[model samples]
Target: MERGIIKIENGEIIIPDTPVWMTVGEMSDLFMVSAYGIRKALRQIFRSGIMDEHDAVRPFPYAEGCYAEAYNMEAVVAVTFRINAAACRRFRELMLRRFMEKSLDFYICIPAADCNHRTGYDAAQVWQERHKLS
Candidate 1:
């Protein structure tokens, strides 16, 4: 079976199309990490309550009369945060920047006083506080 296309630009990996599921081997290749490492990270992710296996993983028919465990995009992102690799570092940076941008955009849409009153703090600061990993 053909794995979906993956692109890396400016050290960040991107899946251009939706509904792209990747196996452990494929994700290991994409992130430049060992397959064992990927599996370990996945287990840690599940253990940490970051994501549920049933929601993140599914069975994919990779070949005739054969199936492999596949991971969804949310699982990919969660693992990216858990693993230690060059690609994972870059991906985390990209995700953090995007999250901050979105928080700032949301802040701009609301009055500063209203935002403070609604969240009891600055939106960006709240986001940073909530997303601090380790």
Candidate 2:
């Protein structure tokens, strides 16, 4: 199977508008690991019950007469966490950073009046100061 292209910019991974489903070979290329390594990680991921094989993987027609096993985004993330490689580390870090940013954004959007008074701290000010937002 041909490897799908993964784009990264300014240390952030860029996902395509359309959902991507990649075969083991494609994931190996994208993660800069051997196909065997990907399979190994997938085995562990499934064995640990982190993801269900039926939900995470599906067979897709890659050629006129052949079908290959392809993994969805959730499976891809699970595999990334299991793999030990520079690409995997970078992916994990970027995903965590994005999650934290989103959480902070949500918190900051809440008005100071809505913030919990029990903490005796203003959540909005704290977030703005920490993020260096004027």
Candidate 3:
């Protein structure tokens, strides 16, 4: 949280390092709501001007000459903030839980050698030798 604003180093909600894409139908299923309802809520969120249509909705190819409304995490987060639905709240909670889990995994998995290697050439030399990257 740099300067009191939430900044995700890698804002990939699903795979941690990969972009997350969610179709409107899928989100409706997750939220246990109708697809039209979800779409309406999203449109309201968009009208608030927190995010642009490009950032919120995208064309997702589902079949030949067919496209569906797909949303990214940014849009989902914004919608969750504006709505008071229980399902939306639950979705936000799950997202937060997953984000925290991924973040913890990232910190725990950083190699000690790699951490030391950033300090000096001597450490880098040692790290290289130990990892056989020389």
Candidate 4:
């Protein structure tokens, strides 16, 4: 990246952006694992509203792109406050829409990082929260 934002020296995409969300295939490629494993990890993310499904493609939730996004902690927490843990599960619901469904209506928005639109997430806090050590 000529923008001095991020580097991809070894195929490991070092993201300069935050709150990055990706599909099982992309996550598996990043993690160097199988898509099935990615799906396993995503089960929790989907339940947390940190990820969502996009029915536009089919009923398989493959369109996870249609709803997932980087959101401020306040926004997330605010939306979270309105939902219960059981409701977060993707088995029967899209956690994001149960919370911030309005974001789904947005057709155009700024990229999480520069030099490319899909390089990163919009909220560093979301990524930190997801990967943060407990």
Every model's TM-score? 0.65, 0.68, 0.55, 0.27
lDDT against the true structure, each candidate: 0.77, 0.81, 0.64, 0.38
Q: Which scores greater on TM-score, model 2 or model 3?
A: 2
lDDT of 2 by residue, 79-130 (tens): 8988889998998889888877884533326576756678888777777778
- Scored by TM-score, the top model is 2
Q: Which stretches of candidate 2 lie over 4 Å from their true place?
A: 1-6, 103-134
Q: What is the lDDT of candidate 3?
A: 0.64
50 in model 3: Cα distance from truth in Å? Answer: 0.4
> Which model is ahead, 2 or 4, in terms of TM-score?
2
**lDDT tens digits by residue: candidate 4, 1-134:** 11112223443335445433344444334334565644454444556775453321121233555543222223322332333433223212343444555545544343444333375544544555677846
Clashing pairs in 3: none
Clashes of 2: 0
Top-lDDT structure, candidate number? 2
Clash-forming residue pairs, model 1: none
Backbone clashes under 3 angstroms, per model? 0, 0, 0, 1
- Candidate 4 achieves a global lDDT of 0.38
Off-target runs (Cα >4 Å) in candidate 3 are 1-17, 97-134
